[model samples]
Target: MLNFVDWLASTSGSIALRESLYMYPWIESAHVLFIAIFFGTLLFVDLRLTGYGFKNLSISQMNSKILPLTIIGFILMITTGLLLFYALPIRNYHNLFFRIKLFLMLLAGLNAWHFHRTMNRQGKAWDKNSFIPFWMKASATISLVLWGLVIISGRMIAYNWFDCDKQPQSELVNFLISCTVDPEIYEYLNGI
Candidate 1:
């Protein structure tokens, strides 16, 4: 699996992205911008759901108004994020912060899924009520925390503090990330 990832990382598309003077930075900027839009909209909706703010609009109405923008932002973010990942698949796949970000993202997705499945099924029963159910509030809180952590982890990926290449080879970081470092890639990174 690691070998295949390394191979993909070395592909033409990846190489092109790495070699391009502006493509990588532009894509990264897009990723960050989209993330801001996505998370910002999400925060508003979640805050309304938790009865913290946006009390003027009902929960259903708030969701309806903001969900489209959130989806759009999410789509754009994912697209740019994938391109960025392709540019250095092996480095990202082995990074602890990247792994944590992925995990948090998965949790956030599941939380959203569960919220939609359960709370949304109740129609407008609690939509107009400022006092949302405990479960809904908990879900909203969890989403906020998970998304915040995801952003932090994503930012940490650019730092070499805990990067795989900077760690001791014998450390268990590889096993934790579920990927081994390719020798050539290791040597290349070390030589830099």
Candidate 2:
């Protein structure tokens, strides 16, 4: 896995991104913009599921109105995120925060899948009820927490404190970063 990631990091696409003055920033900006849109729409629906707002609208109605926009924003966010990751595959693969963010994203996806499969199985039956199912409220709350963690972890990846390049010369740090310690790269990093 490390070898494959290292090779990907050295590929022409990654090299071009590193060399291009604007490509990386543009992709990053797009990723952030789409994230806002995606999360915004998702939050609205999740809030409704929690019976906190949008009481006038049926759950099915709100979901029908907002889910499409959320899906579109998600598609755009994922596309741009992949491009950003390809730009610095190794650095991202080694970043702890990135790992955490990915894990949380997976959990969030699973939570949504479960909620849809179960709570939404009955269709519009509960859509007009004043009180949402406890399970649905729990799912919404969990989704919010998971996404919040993902966002925080994603933002922390930009800080140099735990970045591979700034890691201390310790075995734990080396192992965490999956540092191959290739002589060429090590020497290059060391200003050889």
Candidate 3:
């Protein structure tokens, strides 16, 4: 299974689509720009949920307006992110920070999805309540924190704090490589 995942990661269109010179960087830049927009819009929405600001607009109405921008940003982000990852799947596959970023991204998405579902189920109690629910606040806080971590983790990947070839073995690295490839990449490196 590990071998399969690694092969898939290497074979994915993200890596293959950007063999052209300079294109990878261009796509990566676009990915970063879109991520900025996504996070900015998310910050606005989350802050509103937590009663930080945006007083005049109803949450539903605000959601309607900004949701389109968010979706657009997501499209740009996912497309370019995949491309960038594909551009160097092996490098990313073995990076500890990259694995952490991916985990946070999944959690962030689930948190957002759960928040949307709960809001839909509520009967205007949120609008009437003077204080936001503690759970909602927690979710919003987690969203922000996770996203910040995602960005930080991504940036950290470029630093080569410990190249896969130089790092010691651990369950975390073993698990991450299994997500996208064989353990041999790390095993071969850590063995030395």
Using TM-score as the measure, which candidate wins? 1
lDDT of model 2 at position 113: 93
Ranking by lDDT: 1, 2, 3
Instruction: Evaluate model 3: give its lDDT.
Output: 0.76
| Residue 157 in model 3: lDDT | 81
lDDT of 2 by residue, 11-82 (tens): 999999978999999999989999899988889999998886787888888889999999999999999988
In model 1, state the lDDT of residue 54: 79
Model 3 segments more than 4 A misplaced = 5-19, 167-192
Runs in model 1 with CA error above 4 Å? 128-130, 167-170, 178-192
Q: Give candidate 2's error at residue 112 in angstroms.
A: 0.7
lDDT of 3 by residue, 1-192 (tens): 446546856664645564667787788788889999988998888787777778687777667778789889988898888767766776677777888899999999999899878888872777666456789889988998999899899888876554556545564655665433455756776676
Q: What lDDT score goes with residue 157 in model 2? A: 85
Global lDDT scores for all candidate models? 0.85, 0.83, 0.76
Where model 2 places Cα greater than 4 Å from the true spot, the runs are: 128-130, 169-174, 180-192
**Taking the tens digit of each residue's C-alpha lDDT, what string does model 1 give over 46-134?**
99887767788888888899989999999999999999989989888878889889999999999999999887668468854546778
Q: Which candidate is the best by lDDT?
A: 1
Candidate with better TM-score, 2 vs 3: 2
lDDT of 1 at 126: 85
